[model samples]
Target: MTLFVVSIILSAAMLHAVWNAIVKTAADRTTMLGLVALGHVIPGAAMVVLLPLPAPESMPYVLASTLIHFGYFYMLGRAYAHGDLSVVYPIARGIVPALVALWAMIFAGEVLPLQAWGGIALIALGIQLSSWQALRSGVESGVGRAALGYAVGTGFCISAYSLTDGLGVRLSGNTLSYWAWGAFLHLFVAGFIGLRKRNTLAALRPRTWIIGIGGGLVSMTAYGLVLYAKNFAPLGAVSALRETSVIFAALIGFVFLKEGNWIRRLGAAVLMAGGVALIGTSL
Candidate 1:
């Protein structure tokens, strides 16, 4: 990958970790989700208008992306209910690049040299090893136990969106438009579901608004950067690099949240670095 693309991926990784940390602290799911939607909705709407509309051929991919993202939001909510940012985010974000590699090979017809496969394995293994800490720590915190199942599910959902969005943007010939539309439609689904219930709409706290808007902006920026980086670099490389958000999330959890153990954090860091090294060897 080019230096520019790597830099973009790293920037996106940082933003992605930061916003996810914000989300994990949210107390009200409905309001938080809605406010997050609002944040994306503004940027998404603006981007949609700024860019040319997608070709009709790309609409199917866009719709599929929207559905997949709904699942992403739903599963994210469920995972947050069970775990901390350190545990759940790493597990969820860590799983997708490997799966995306397989998906790309089979469905997208993207090829990886043998070294790439080995690198992917290290990425997967690092994610798995990091998760062991969560399994043990979660029991005591009671925060991460339920997140195990939900976080796993969220991983699949994220892969769906990642691959689908990658394909859609590549096909549409407009990555910006594809991502903006996906973001808007995604927020639409989350917003509708949140508003459907009884009193969920009545209560909206200031923190929710602040965090949600900030998260939405950061999240949208991160996705935009990812889409751009994917276009310029190999999909697997982009995905693998992006998953380093787990490392960032772990650090944020430790420094800001002060809930993480040093040993587990170190392990997570080493595994993530190993994954990056393995990925670099392939290149």
Candidate 2:
């Protein structure tokens, strides 16, 4: 990957971490997530009006990606409800690069070099290190196995959509159009979640709307950058770099939410940064 592409992906990673932190600190995760979806819809709706449609070939991938994202959002909300940002975020984000690498190799025909694979492994290891305490003590600490299961499921959904969008954007012939349409699909996810929490909608405060919509916009921009990066880089390599957001999310949790063990988490973040640097060199 070029430095330009790597920088774009890293920026997206940071933004991704920020939005997740917003959701992590929210009082109502599901409702807040719905609002985030609204965030996506607002910009997406505007882009749809301004940009031309993606190729028909890309539509199937877009639909598939949207469906996978619904599952991702559902599992993410459930994971947060059952666990801390430090624990759930690491496991969910850590598992995706490997899965995406596998899928990219099989479907996208993108085979990475040994050094790149090593970098990816190191990144995943660093992510696990960030949550080592939580995983070791999760059961005794009452974090529960269910939360872990949900997080892993969320990871699967992430890999599914990452590959879907990676391919979809390449096929679309217009990165902006693909991203805009993908953002618009968030409306469906928000609508589905809103229907389930219909009673809460009337009671939501302005603060809630601001946080949720703002988070959605951040999340949309983050992933939009990733989609654009995929056009220039190998999917697996890009996915590995993007998972650095796990480290960012860890820091965000510690600083913003007052989560514990900052020293160790920061150390893990350093390790992840090193891993990203290795990947950059490999490229």
* RMSD (Å) of each candidate, 1 decimal: 2.8, 1.6
lDDT of each: 0.76, 0.89
Q: Which window of ten consecutive residues has the lowest lDDT sum in model 2?
A: 251-260
lDDT of 2 by residue, 115-198 (tens): 888889989998998878877777678888889999999999999999999999999999999999999988899899899999
Clashes of each: 1, 0
Q: What is the lDDT of residue 240 in candidate 2?
A: 94
Per-residue CA lDDT of model 1 for 93-200, tens digit only, reads: 778888788788888888888776676667666655655677557767666446888898999998888888778778877877887887777667656866674376
For residue 12, what is the lDDT in candidate 1? 94
Best by TM-score: 2
TM-score of 1: 0.87
